[model samples]
Target: MKSVYPILILALVLLSACNPKSTKQEIALGDTIQTASGLKYIYLKKGDGRKIETGCKVGAYLSLKVKDQVVWNTNKLPDSLFTYLADYSRLIKGFTEVSMLLREGDEVVAILPDSLAYGAKGAGDIIPPHSTLIYDQFKVLKVDAPKKFLSDLLYADVKERSLNAAVATFQKITEGEESENYYTDSEQLNRVWEQLSRDSLYAKAADYAVKFGELAKDDRLKYRNVLSLESMGEYLKAKDHLEILLADDPENKMMQDKMIDLCKKHRMNNK
Candidate 1:
């Protein structure tokens, strides 16, 4: 009997070693559904609003945890929600899977296996290797069309960079891409540039102004870039841009007056 017992115990140990299904016990607590992609989630509440789809611009509030430690909490930020285009390739596998199943006002708590979250390498300084991420809360707050989303993001929100990325996506849908161009053609590029400058987002305005100048090789866009730089108090850089403009057209009175004003500011800044 003792010999048989030893054989049985050894068999159980080997079976457990060969099979990793037992690891699910760690995340099986509470009422949770293990999705097809291995995302384990508990639906805290069901939403009655708009459904999420491929191009839906989404907003959500999240509290991410690793074991007992919190890695991210939206409640601590000035705005309680983070906005993103619901293009899953740009997001972690766990967030993508859960997001696809959500609608506006839906909330869920999810546990992402090590393979789905950060994989073996983990995120720098934020996640550890072979970590299981726990989303204590993920609440879908809003969903809107791309244009409406861009409008709200630009004039109302601080996520100007997201606006840029979303705009680039309109031109091409490459996986894991973020771009600052924010326009598909020269005409739209000018509109976005003018809008940013109107809103006093001069740094991004200057960035696009330079991009427009490079693409069209237009002196007017170059002058727009100079104006944006001047607005940002980059007097020295603005003066350099003015000098380039002057080199091209030394006989223009308007550009000459602009250069003189800029040089005085540059000299004062140097002093």
Candidate 2:
């Protein structure tokens, strides 16, 4: 099925970036190659691996920048973008045109003009209308076998359907350079946890809270995690986590309040 892969979004609901390697292809490192599709790029490194083809599952890293502002960067994501070559649904608009021409381990600085990218409508508030996006840092990390892509896609589709549309497509767009969606940005993930908690999606909130804590330890997030676990009736987990927090911050009134609340709930449940 065809999918619309628009260009970039602020703080990175968009997609993935890797460190550039400085190996030149037939073209010099700084030489520009403009594809007929109007993609102008400079080769920073050339891949020595298999050339990417239509059926290949490509894993790549790229940072989308409109002028000096960052629309998205894959490096901020601990994972690379996993998609098929020429699959419009799985990639940025016009990026497939370039990906199909690349090979595993290739790195390029691609300038996707406004016309080829988001066009006049642009993306959300992050990308201005008619703005050109620059991938001054774009790298092809790996090319994998095609078989697993379908399974991964199926899993994601299932997860998206399990929740209401608004909750499932939770608005992750952030102002400025804060990260989005990925575990790499604890700041944005904490905000996401806040939203999920507000909606009382405690299970999902707990999941993200774990990842948020992993990225950066925040006491507030730790406390909120306990609340999520408590709401989900994982009382032991909640109490254990709270105990850890209290050991570190014994004077906190909020934790004390929760201890009282948990005790009441526990007694009521036992009775």
Candidate 3:
């Protein structure tokens, strides 16, 4: 009976060795790279494109989770993805650090310690205080140079509450004739002009409205430009644009009313 038991044990050991549980399917925790700031990550797909730079506008699809529970996912949003200026101040420390290490088209799984994530205070109701975060899949879809979008430049200034900086960034973005010419054909420039008009920086917004209006071929955009200028107290410029529109469409009641209202306001202010 003792000899038979040994033989059975030996046969079982041989069978286990042949199968070996297939280690190829498993990911060893040690394989992940940990940064000095304690951000741990593993790349699922390495990108060959240009590296992301600070102030660049990045459009990405991202998913955040704690354990198996999802916290927020860009994929679930109406846009299915989000675009943001790659400023570290606006993102979790771990995410910013890992983003710097990746390029367009790269996909990664990252684990952020509490210190690099929401930290002691955490976020409102969603992430608990001092809890770690897991970015299950972050895929960079597009990387636009800082100069590609005027909104990217304007956002940095707006975030810092520096109107002067905003003006400077706008000037930097539209420095040369070549750059200005590029914007003439860009639909994104129109979107940015509209966004600026909605921003609280009235002076800057009005400036963009007038400049973009001159470049715009669409009558609707030109009308918005006049309205934006008027809102910023640039009555003379607004009136000039209104007159031009009224010439093209002599009986446009909306334009006529705007012109009449501007004249009334001018007389009232002078009186």
**Whole-model Cα lDDT per candidate?**
0.74, 0.66, 0.73
The alpha-carbon lDDT assigned to residue 109 of candidate 1 equals 90
Stretches > 4 Å off in candidate 2: 1-25, 80-88, 147-271
Model 1 segments beyond 4 Å from truth?
1-30, 146-271
Worst 10 residues of 2 by lDDT: 146-155
Q: By TM-score, how accurate is candidate 2?
A: 0.44
The candidate, 1 or 2, that scores higher on TM-score is 1
User: What TM-score would every model get versus the actual structure?
Assistant: 0.47, 0.44, 0.48
Q: What's the lDDT for residue 14 in model 2?
A: 24
Model 2: per-residue lDDT, tens digit, 1-271? 1333333343234232231333333577788999887888888998888777655657788788887888787755557564444442345666877777788889998888888788889889988888888887878888854321222222232235442332233323223232222222334335556667676778877765664465456666777888899989887778888888899889999888888888778778778
Going through the candidates in the order shown, the clash numbers are 0, 5, 0
Task: Give the alpha carbon lDDT tens digit for every residue of 1-271 in model 1.
Answer: 7789989999999998889885455422256888777888987887888888766778899999987799888886658888766752258887887888889988889899988888989999889899999999888999875332222233332234544563454434222343232223344445556778888989877876776577556567788889999999998898898888889899989989988888999889889
List the candidates ranked by TM-score, beginning with the highest: 3, 1, 2
For candidate 3, give the lDDT. 0.73
